[model samples]
Target: MIVGIDISKKWFDAAWQVDGQGRHQRFEYTDEDIGQLLAQTPEAAHYVMEATGTYHARLALRLHESGRRVSVVNPLVIKRFSQMQLSRVKSDRADAELIRRYGEQQPLSPWAPATDEVLELQQAHGWLNDLIGERTRLLNRREAHAHHAKPNAFVISQMAAQLQQLDGQIKTCERHLEVMVKKSFTELFERLLTIPSIGAKTAIELIIVTDGFRRFEDVKALCAYIGVSPTTFRSGSSVNGKGGIAKLGQGRMRQLLYLCSWTAKTCNPACRALYARLKALGKPPKVINVAIAHKLLRQAFAVATTNAPFSTEYA
Candidate 1:
């Protein structure tokens, strides 16, 4: 029985028994509720739900423990899909139905959580990033006030001290995560470390972004998945080769890649040559920057996929 689940905190709605033989049935999300539902279900392959607000995770884990195949779709993909439905309506039932069709209509894969260390790194990294963003925003506002508002009234010195403290903490957290990564993935970390520009932080960030390198099938697909592929678009009779970074994948991954690009431009001969060649061909600085980022991802992907150190010989 294929199932589409609309997950919430206490209760969940399910588009039931998607054998295409019946309509839909809703159920509560509890041990008893799930146990009873499982009793009635004729063993199925896939159970699909959206990755809804960290709530779906527990239920999915429980379901998996009980020998059921459960998968969580990203909300963005599911919502974008909902727009295409001819009779699109906003309701729990509608959501469940969309999930049902998403399961039924497409070959959706199961959800798998990253390992504890990767999860820890992601949590720490995201928190530090948020803190940094908040600090930047506060600093920027204070500076703007000092320049444009009552200049004497706005004070920025104390906040600058706080910013320095936050920066130190963020760096400490990053170093700990990097150490954890080195312990967890010894071989991969060693290989990535050989690349002068691919540092511990960048490699660990890649692990989180790759979900421990599980989803990608190969390097080209990895590049596309990271949204580093230069896309193409056509309008009416005109074609433009101007589509840049897809900006659709993990932001953290893209950030690491950008940093890698900057580092490689200095430390990597191939990357330096490529960047120069593109500049010579009249590419915009931003375009060349993005291309450099893409190249770094490809190198990182190659290292991860092959479990080998990056070779300058590839250049």
Candidate 2:
């Protein structure tokens, strides 16, 4: 038995199949509702739900605590499954049914909650990103005000104060994140830092995202998960296009890797050689950077699995 749940901010819809027929129910986001739903389903039934940001966390955690089997899948996977089934209905009820059928048909691994340290690092990283975003907005506002013909001194001073404050907050958050990583993943953090162009922040971000590298077993899967793996688009000679990243995974991580690639191409021996060879072949700058980012991920994975620091001599 499998129950598919479509969760929202306030409620969720659950669907399952019984006697070759469909059964569906809606419930509020509460302990009582969750208990009732569990009672209604078979003890052996598997519950599957999409990872809907933080909205699904409460229910998923509750389910796991109650000893029910829970599988939290990526939303992209469910979207692809829906497309394959030619699903046209776009309601919560339909989504729940689709999720149920997906669980029943596809092989899925159970989701594991992140450890306390990793979770705390993730929260801190998210806060840092938010602060960075705010800083950017403040910068743009300052620039706009500067060109305001009159350029009010009062507004400019306020913006400057705000920017300084945000910078301090961002630095504090980053420092806290590094401390958390060092406390829980000291060896991994140090190892990752040995890779050229991979600084403390990048290493911390990778650990937080990969849950200390327990989420993936190999470099290939990690590359794909980080959205740095190459994707081809060619059906026949008549229909062909340039290959690029799939861009179906973590966008923020992908962006961060891309930024790191700029430095990696110059300092990292392996990446430098690859960049030179690709540049010789006339590959575009963006294409070359993506490749370097991919290479960085490969190095990160290798060091993580081998429990060793990266060495330029190995290049």
What tens digits encode model 1's per-residue C-alpha lDDT throughout 1-315? Answer: 577889888888877654456556666777888776667665664679988866887778877877888888889888878877665588988888788888878787776666677777678777767877877787787677677645653256676677788788878877787777777777887887787688777777777667667668888778877778787776777666567667777677787778778878778887899888998999987788789888888777787777778788974
Off by over 4 Å in 2: 313-315
- Report model 2's TM-score to 2 decimal places: 0.93
TM-score of each: 0.88, 0.93
In model 2, pairs of residues that clash are none
Model 1 misplaced regions, further than 4 Å: 18-29, 151-158, 239-241
- Give one digit per residue, the lDDT tens place, for model 2 in 1-315: 999999999999999988988899999999999999999998888999999978988898888888889999999899999999999999999999999989989998997677677677777877888898899899988888888779988998899899999999988888888888899999999999999999877888898889889899787888888888898888977869889898877787888888999999999999999999999999999999999999998889889888889988764
C-alpha RMSD values across all candidates:
2.6, 1.8
For model 2, state the Cα shift of residue 60 in Å: 1.0
